[model samples]
Target: MNEQNDNAGLFGSGDEAPSNHSNNPHFNDLVAGITRRQILASSAALGSLAFLGATLPSLAEAGEQTVASQPLKRRNRLPFTAIPTSRADTISVPPGYKATPFIPWGTPITGRYPAFADDASNSAQDQAEQTGMHHDGMHFFPIDAQRGLGRQSDHGLLVLNHEYIDAPLLHPNGPTVVNGKRVNAEEVRKEINAHGVSVVEIRRNVRGEWDVVPSPRNRRITAATPMQIRGPARGHKLLQTRYSPDGKATRGTQNNCSNGYTPWGTYLTCEENWAGYFASADADMPRELSRYGLRSSSRFGWNTLPGDEFERFDATRKGASATADYRNEPNHFGWIVEIDPFNPESVPIKRTALGRFAHEGLIFAPAKAGRPLVCYSGDDSQNEYLYKYVSRDRYWPGFSHGRLLDEGTLYVARFNADGSGEWLALDITNPRFLKACLTARVTFADQGEVLINTRLAADVVGATKMDRPEWGAVHPDTGEVYFTLTNNTARTLADAANPRIANAYGHIIRWREQSRDHTGTRFNWDLFLLAGPQTDSRGPDGTALTADNTLASPDGLWFDPDGRLWIQTDMSGSQLSNGPFGNNHMLVADPRSGELKRFLVGPLGAEITGITATPDFRTLFVNIQHPGEGSTATNLLSSWPDGPGKRPRSSTVIITREDGRHIL
Candidate 1:
């Protein structure tokens, strides 16, 4: 989900820092009187005006080590600091509170047409009228019909997750290709309908309100949107692309990245760096080129250039068969999608019984009438494997009550270094590993090639390989799940769920579940935080540590509605891309006091992607993206969430705690 880089924004240093930690003045006078009772009432009058302006903080609502034992510091804390470069476009919180843009980057949407013009000419209906650009992992579903309620909120259903696009500020003078091919099939169908998922519906206005309700039931699910792949790598033949010649509808849903929702509400999303946007030629099929992991998909020159939407991402076959040319458009793209963000007519279903790699997040587990509802996923690649599906039916919480997300039963994941792990079942009852609908080798016409070769049948059943895993949350109070192994520069040579070798910085595994507390068959784990930098560097037994508990590449991860967790950096290794681990920051962990801070640091060439909160844990969004990518969008490097001459636009900001507390 990062490469073409540069959305610009770093207006050569100016300076200005000292506000936001509730931007003080009495924590912005208590989130300005409880968000002005959320724009003047109507979530049961803002839960009776937050139980008449909810007082009773007992240490700001005990969570995250009670907001990390209250001493926050940082008016210039670590030897680390930066954001002053005239604070371009502005958004530097931590002092007392204040962050706005709950969503930006061609904003407005309600079905279609409004965003276009950073020089214009983008259509696929300006990607359902815009709101997709590196957003990443979100969740706010609190229309609270009250069930364990107390943290009152006004309106909800945010979803959000774009995860890709910058192609020279998204068109008008960039992304054309014209000769090596790809002269913009309508700017690659407006950058694959500005990559997937949107949902918006937030509320609470009238001075005590939430935001984003652009209306007409605002919705969008791009990358062409039109799913239904469901399990066992649907029609395998590696997801046969070229516009579903036989892959069963799959127009789009690129890099998606983190997101989850179920309990019967449905939303899932996920799809990390989706096999580097295709380039493949690694000598015409080196085993479908090392079975669908494409070591070079992001050369971003868009397959020779000029169109048929970037020459169907070169899957070879060069013509004569597979129903002539366009070699099945990169097997439709890494799976997991799901949507139905509250059924806006619904249709986003890639579930393929959930098994595609590069995915990154999918949580869900607490469902147990008769058992088998489990979910947990992660395969963000690099050493892959750590999936789970289990759902041969049992959860009837509303039993798909408004269109249940198609039956379930997908599995693949093994992890066991005595640490213990096992789920397996990519099923067909495993006739020699994922084979099933064998109408003579046409294999699995149903569970979609078992979630599309679910990482080649978890490498034909063995499973385990990790490191790069990215997001996964849960523990709405001990249902425990936590994930983020995010950095593993290919550890050990032994294969199978990472046997252990030069792993680099990464570690944060978690577990717990023996019988339906979000059951993934059986659970119980450990080894929580271990990113890197305490010393040794990479070893004399090197575990390294400290950047306030050092963190190398731990990509976008969340866990808010008060269970804490946050994290965010992509670090880029080589000592944070160019010395002294500068940009990319968001940290805040505390999984029961293993502590670790940082709280916010993103600017000069950003990377701290997505975070989400707002279920009354009062605001907290996140998502910086592209800041100063490949440089020069007019000499930018990061004006941050808003700064500089205005070019960097991978928006989403929110953040709160200077006194409205509760931000461990």
Candidate 2:
């Protein structure tokens, strides 16, 4: 989720500005109807309320309440001393903590465990058996289920998403091209093989050091792996590509960014910026393609080569029918893919009932035994909408499965000026939504078509255009949902939900469901914090941020077992310009007191992301992605984990306390 201006061409590049949400009602219009004094008064009144109370217990709390015949007690304060920000080309942690790099890119996990070559000489076949590149949202699934879910601290399967690739660092040289076309097929294949998810079995040895263990459970699901399409949009006419004429299946998952997990023990990897991988030469593209930012060219020139596998990247109508050419290839992407880490033989399923866009990630609300299963997600592009999905059937304790995700109602949010919001259903059966579509002259044949063009449907319903909504987290005790709106440079109007214009520095917003009901259509929200430098930023209490907590672009967010909010920053383009914030870092905040402290900082040219921990909360894992991002094969910007003269590869860092105490 790098929302920098330099990568604008690869993301939301088109004739229409990304901020332009068609002719529908703008967020500014909602704010203009209220007085400024009234808006400020409402914010000040809500600032004193405690986010967590004796409300409904969240699913996170329900699962962890009883660890070993004892109730899990929540910690009231942060234990570790806060570390200062840094610019050094290495990981920085507190004085009593140790950080070790583990299983970097090209580390073989399966088959004949091929070691990584520093010169990037590994073949595509070797890449299939190794860890993927640019590790992002991750989780640790304990193999010792005897201790129950999220209770084991010794062994587990480490599942993480490989968001994307840096071709210059991936190949012997950069991408090879002759006359503006890719000349090497192996290079393209290896790049494709590096774009999915990795499942590795890891354990702690006798020395208490965490290391990767070679096991049959180790596997890689790349862009060429077979996957099944499931949900309302599955087998639709729009999904009828040359590969899957019936549209019941697709080949792979790419651009997987953030992630989620189910109570049934399945992994959910989201597809972000997936539209950039496809190119359509047609001048007049369908609303489904145009609304999601598909263009005349792709991010990587995988479509420039010969062969059906390579030609699939070129989504043009040439054979006079949707099934003849790859015109509908783009429809196969932009989904929430589910994988069972425990079962290596199972096929990944793309759950389409959860409306598709640039899904940053998905977070489930607390699952009640007889209540409907509910989850929330966000579109990562500028001015996109936030969404919620509620299953049609009630949840059952041990009988829940992926089928629960197939039949559901998807809704987009609309924030009003008074801080109260409503969830507008995206279903065509809803009279209000259908009327809005008819008024806008947008027609949909069925719910499948409405979901396929989800962005356009959101636009027609007058949903609030948010500042790039990224990861979301639900409080274990309170069930309050928090989402990070990564900075949006294109925004010029102010709204109650997003109050800043030209919002270079983003903010965190949270909401509580009405009457403690997750299935309710209403919520009450407030701004948690405005992220920027000390002089301009505001904390939870509306005071200026201190030097110890100044930051920007809050990307990855998670709440530890004890209810500590861990925040990771992605200040990509602003790292050099923003002098006060030295580099990308991680912070810990007590939501009860609004006290925040800088905990860890990553190397230069890297974004700190993907965080998880052992069940005991003693061993924590964090990822450093794309170190020395702009470096080429010859000139290196950073050589992290390894010293100088070595390539800076994206690797996961394991953090542990010297005294062997809990992380909180």
| lDDT of each candidate versus the true structure | 0.56, 0.83
Can you write out model 1's per-residue Cα lDDT over 1-664, one digit (the tens) per residue? 3232222121111111111111111111112223322322222211111112223122223332334565332221122232221222344545555666556656766755475455445465766677876677776666552221224466766777887766666665566564445554566677777777787777778874357776655687876666767544556555655566676666668778677767655567887666556656646554333466554334454555655556666666666665455555555566677776655776777765665566767777666555666778776655556776666556564443312334566665554433345566766666645443342243444556555555655555555555556677766665667687766543334222222356555666666555554544445454455565555232101123454445566666666655556777765425445544565676665443333566676655666676666555666667776666644455555555445555666767766654655444
Candidate 2 runs further than 4 Å off: 3-20, 25-29, 32-76, 145-150, 494-500
lDDT of 2 by residue, 1-664 (tens): 7734454433222122363447655555655655433332222222233332223333334543575645455455677777887888989998899999998998899989998999889999999999999999998888864122556788999999999888888898877878767779999999999989999999899999887888988999999899999999989999998889999989889999899988777899999888888889999998888888888888787888889889989998889788898989898888999999888899999999998788999999999889899999999877788999999998887788899999989999997766678899999899999899888898999999988988988888889877788999998877889999888877777755455678777988888888464998988776677798887677655566787788888889999987778999888766544578878999987665567888998998898999988889899999889888777789999998677998889999999898888876
lDDT leader:
2
- RMSD vs true structure, all candidates: 23.4, 4.4
Task: Give the Å error, residue 487, model 1.
Answer: 36
Q: What TM-score does prediction 2 earn? A: 0.93
TM-score of each: 0.32, 0.93
